[model samples]
Target: MVDFFYSNQLRYRISRHLLYWLSFNLFLAFIWGSTGESYQIHLTVQALLWPARIFVVYGTLYVLIPKFFLKRNLFVFGISYIIWLLLVTIFVQRTVWQYSRSFFFPDWKNYDMFNVTEIMGNVFDLNLAAVFPLVFVFVKFYNAEQKKYLTLEREQYKSELNQLRNQIHPHFLFNTLNNLYSLILKKSDEAEDALIRLSGLMRYMLYEANVPKVPLSKEIEYLRNYIDLEKLRLNASNTIHFTSSMNKDQEIAPFILMPFVENAFKHGISNDKVSTIEISIIANKDLLTMTVYNTKKINANQDNGEKTGVGLVNVQKRLELLYKDNYEMIRNETESHYKMELTLNLI
Candidate 1:
């Protein structure tokens, strides 16, 4: 209960409501006291009655009426408050007469003929006229304040997600560059070709990845470039089987598939003997499927000298955030083979 009331949001609204209610009653009390003796009320009675009247009528109207009805419906709201005022008038007059017979004695209970017309007139003329404008003033400012807070929260989340994505891409690029460095050290002619492929991959990352989504064809091209670069480092005796079937028009988030391909290259391909890597991608309508298989190298030493790094872990987080329950990934292992199959709903 304390958490609810003391929340940043509730505290602000409660503070504003109290100020508006008090200020409105103070102004109304001054005008009501300055009016004719027939309408005059004792200072002590006025103090008690005004607060009770505001709480009973406006409080009920604001709390109950708005619950079952739209807040913008001023007509229904006005009618509900008029009804509240009628009940309050009856109760106030009865209580006064019961307490003091001389209060309205000359004509007694029939002095002010209580009826629908008189109640509605009093509601509009006294209760609502005094409160509605003030309530609207508070409501307008409060809604604007809430909108501002929501906008700030949205921007903050966007910035944080972007920062995480930026960190992931650089981590991936650093690993790829280290692989290319190994090729250069061995005096391989493929270094130039690898550099060219790296340039194209970097262009996609720098340009297309700034947007939230990219054409599926573009991501596929990026995966192909990465595989081609990896191929340069392996010996001529190695075997790699790669196949892809895709929609030329579909789209997905940029850089989404690169980490999976990197994982396959890191774990599957062996540099020791006759080794093979098999990769395939099939995309149709709203569905995408990718499979990667490679033989585990004997005495396999992982790059970055770590069991696992940022790539696969980041992919898992990205999938959870982007696809939620819409994607499925399965990995299988055998004595001579390891494979991963993934299906994603691109729609």
Candidate 2:
């Protein structure tokens, strides 16, 4: 209970609410006694009633609401509140009336309206005062619920993005190891260099790819390392080109752009074809743009194979989840080549 009420920011709101109600009660007392009563009597009545009101309000709000009302025990809450309210009302009348008579009305008889019937007649007035804290508690509870919903929403986004990132790592490792295995079969000296490059790629994946975003410069370096690993399996005649527009400060979602590059290198080559990949990126102001083009060769599996792969599908979902309306991507294909263009806000 102490932890709930005193959560730094929540404590400020609680203190403000307490002050407002106390001041409002003082205002009501002044208006009630405005006809001919002295200011001292108004202040005395307020001072006496303030503690009684506090006891009722906090009891209903902190105790009854959390303990019964929120627990779906409507019957218990209604019964508990009514019983407590009656006790508070009777105690306040006896205590306040006893003190008030001496200064304001010494000639008054205690038997005039002190009976049960007369006291119960003011139930509406008393209940209104007792139940006034419901408004404050309702608003506080609503705001707390909204904050929780937003926190959960943000965490869900992070989880889905990390899932997409994890998918790319294993797919990339599978292809790179394939190239290393081919080199080992041939007993080529280049197998040692390819192993070293694969180690760097795996290290980056373990350390950085799990993050939500990485610097544009770091992503470019990662892209170059990936291409170097791919070169281990390429023929000397295969041409690869990479270019960038020198925007070092911008950041992008990790692994977001890699699937397109991987798709280019994977499906764009055949053992006997002259394969070529051309990649370029440019950042201007707050916008980052990329173009990846690969020459498409005749596929031996095209007669019985599916066209789209999971890497592309995974990245498509990731872009929609992360960027929403802030990003654009387009794929253009022809008989000879496939091209992908993406534009996104850098910040």
Candidate 3:
């Protein structure tokens, strides 16, 4: 639909320009012919003047404007434009008019070819023909500048997004390796299984998650694997529940939902007390909603300086860069619990 609309607009602009030039030529012929005995002769004379007019207009548009006017060399631009105008007026327009008039209307009075007043008048009239196309020059320049600006902005956005995504890899691997270290120290029977799960997670991070977006199902699988790993480090007192419901496969920004779950497991679990972390995801055709809620351990040392984990901060930044106004996040924290709710418009 958008392409169709722009295509129609381009056609309209082309037709309008063609119509304008046709009308302008006819108008010039009618005005000039009114003073002549034969309108047909005057029309032919006007037709002969078209090449000079085209030269003046297009030279100003494609040459002078780009070379000097747009370069902020106004003094040079002014001087060059004046010289160009005079050269075309003298060598093309005036010569064409003189010879064509003498050929068609042999009895008509002829003026001195180099009369300053006569040449100036001719210059003024020729300039009038060049007026309308100047609007096109300025419009083209404005569009070019706007396109350049948008391209730069998009490149900067991608650079920042990639930097944020890279930050997640180290933060995630560091936490997982710490868990593995504890299991190895205890000589736990689950160490080998944990190593296998870590390998799978690393594979996903290294290979699959490098793209701008991934299938929602793949992201969910990653989250489940991370949750299973965290579960291995927990005792009977720590409870974690994760639920997801998706009607269809959809693509989403990679690892966008991982930080909240990581934050919950990091800050909400304790061996000495009962703690709970609840994570839920619901995705439909138009929207994806995720909620993560965790109860803070009572005796755990709380570092109030950084309420949100490092991974969470990077995720929030990524959300702003990727989704802009299409996503909403709500964060609520109290003495007992912390909750994060995110809603994304998938369409």
Candidate that scores best on lDDT? 3
Candidate 3 stretches greater than 4 Å from native: 1-27, 30-59, 72-124, 297-309
Ten-residue stretch with the least lDDT total in model 1: 299-308
User: Who wins the TM-score comparison?
Assistant: 3
Work out the TM-score per prediction.
0.60, 0.71, 0.72
Candidate 3 has an lDDT of: 0.83
Clashes of 1: 0
lDDT of 1 by residue, 113-225 (tens): 35667545544544653466446645654776788899987787577557657866776687689879998898888788888889888888898778878888888888888
User: Model 1 off-target regions past 4 Å?
Assistant: 1-51, 55-101, 105-160, 299-309
lDDT of 3 at 187: 99
The window of 10 residues in a row where model 3 has the poorest summed lDDT is 1-10
lDDT accuracy of residue 162 in candidate 2: 80
Predictions in order: lDDT: 0.70, 0.78, 0.83
Task: Write model 3 residue lDDT over 72-149, tens digit each, in one string.
Answer: 798998899899889987885357757765776676566666888877876776787777777655666677789899
